[model samples]
Target: MKVMKVAIIDYNMGNLHSVGRAVKHVAPGGTQVEITADPDFIRHADRIVFPGQGAARDCMRELETRGLSEIVREVAKTKPFLGICMGMQVLMEFSEENAGVECMGVYAGKVNYFKHLNIAHLKTPQMGWNQIQQKTAHPLWTGIKDAARFYFVHSYYVEPTDQSLVSGETFYGLNYASAIAKDNVFAIQAHPEKSAEDGLRLLANFMQWQP
Candidate 1:
């Protein structure tokens, strides 16, 4: 049998060690997990895990600087691709960040910032644990409860043109599409590496996921 190979795309940004460790911990014994920016290896891998953080414009710049933007869009279409945090946000066509920035365009959407909230307590960069209300059934949601909380640290969230693509939603100041799924692509705005039990389960499910 062919051993499963997972590529954690490296663009010289985000928490690579934590994301890599989390995936390795949950993946089956023989599965291979490689952290790479190389296009050839990435395209050949059976699965792809994209984890990112920091500013939206910077993220796109790095992906482009490393010549990985198009490669990511190409492989995502044919393989089981999982995106996390800023990784999820950049899948959109454009973003209302740093004036404006074009993205990978894997999905028809825009990444919007969390505007100022009326509540004195609520704020942008919705850091900490928040519940993810599953909007659609999916393999990534396996073993995780409907309202399970996941770790998140971001000021922007994605808005897909197609509501049917949303697999999960969360409310900071208002409800937003916190997760999306379609064909071989699945993305979440939460940080599964930092999340505890339920988060690990989600990673494990990704390991066995066929889609």
Candidate 2:
């Protein structure tokens, strides 16, 4: 069997290893899960996974400092790229998480913090499993059942100016976009690798996606 290389950008954030492990399990053996900063590695890979944690501003700074911002932009514009968690948020133009910071600008929007709503009575940092409401069908959600529960752990979320890009949504203190896709870039605010069967199916679907 042939192996397709999948590169997971390792800019010192999030559970990169877990994402790589999950990809490897679904990929044919000998397929790589490279944790690298080399532009060549990213350029040559069949797919890229940007699994992110921590603050959006911090992730942006690291991408800039490592000169990865330019490479990532080029890669995202042309290849199959997936963003997880904060990885998804930073793909937008800005984030409010740190008094506002400019992001990759792959999508036109700003990241906003979750606010308390009188009706929900939920706390911020809406952690734990939440049901993802599928708004549209795409190859990424091919094997994912509608209203599948996925893991989430964040206080802020992205609000895309392009509603057509939103693939799924979920509720916390309020309803917000849980996943987004634009051209070659695909992202999900939830961690599919941690969501068990449904999440794993989502990951598998992504691995099998073609441009």
Candidate 3:
């Protein structure tokens, strides 16, 4: 039996153990989940899960310092790529964080800090569970109901120029792109690993997704 390999990119941003375990749990039998920063390993994997935390500037710097920036861009174009949190944010053209930072530019968008919330109860980071409204039907959302709640922890959110790329949206102070998909790449602002059953189902769908 052949073993499919899933690479969880490590760029010194945050711990990948939870993401690794979640992927391994949902992966079909004989699938290997490796948490690595090695370019060769990432290039050879059947799928790539890029989960990140911390500041965008720091994360991008780490990827460049380790010579993994180009590799990530290449992988996104050719393979089944899933970007979580900061991983998804960095795909944009630029970020307003750290006094403005340039990202991979894979997607034409900008990451902006949450602003102008009239509601006193809402927070900037938008932490905890939030409902995701499916903007469009896709394989990654299979078996997951519309408006499913997912875990989120970020002060900045992505605003893609092209609305068609938005696969899901969530509202806090306003409706923002919670999930974006283009070609073989699908990214979400939420943490599926931390989320419960629906999150697991999404991961399983990604494992079997062909497009």
Pick the winner on lDDT between candidates 1 and 3: 3
* 1-211: candidate 1 lDDT, tens digit per residue: 8999999999977999999999999999899999999899999999999999988889998998999998899988999999999999999999999989988888899998777345566677788999999999999899899999999999888899999999999998889999999999999999999999999999999888997
Off by over 4 Å in 3: 116-121
- Against the hidden reference, what TM-scores do the models get? 0.97, 0.94, 0.97
Task: Write candidate 2's Cα lDDT for 1-211 as tens digits.
Answer: 6568788998888998888778777765577678888889899888898888998878988898888998898988888999999889998998887788999998899898886234456678889999999998888888778998899999888899989989999977667899998777789999988888887787787777886
lDDT of 2 at 184: 78
Model 1 Cα shift for residue 183 (angstroms): 0.5
Give the distance in Å from residue 33's predicted Cα in candidate 1 to where it truly belongs. 0.6
lDDT of 3 by residue, 59-155 (tens): 9999999999999999999999999999999999999999999999999999988854456777777899999999989999999999999999999
TM-score of 2: 0.94
Clashing pairs in 1: none
Order of models, best lDDT first: 3, 1, 2
Each prediction's Cα lDDT score?
Answer: 0.92, 0.85, 0.94
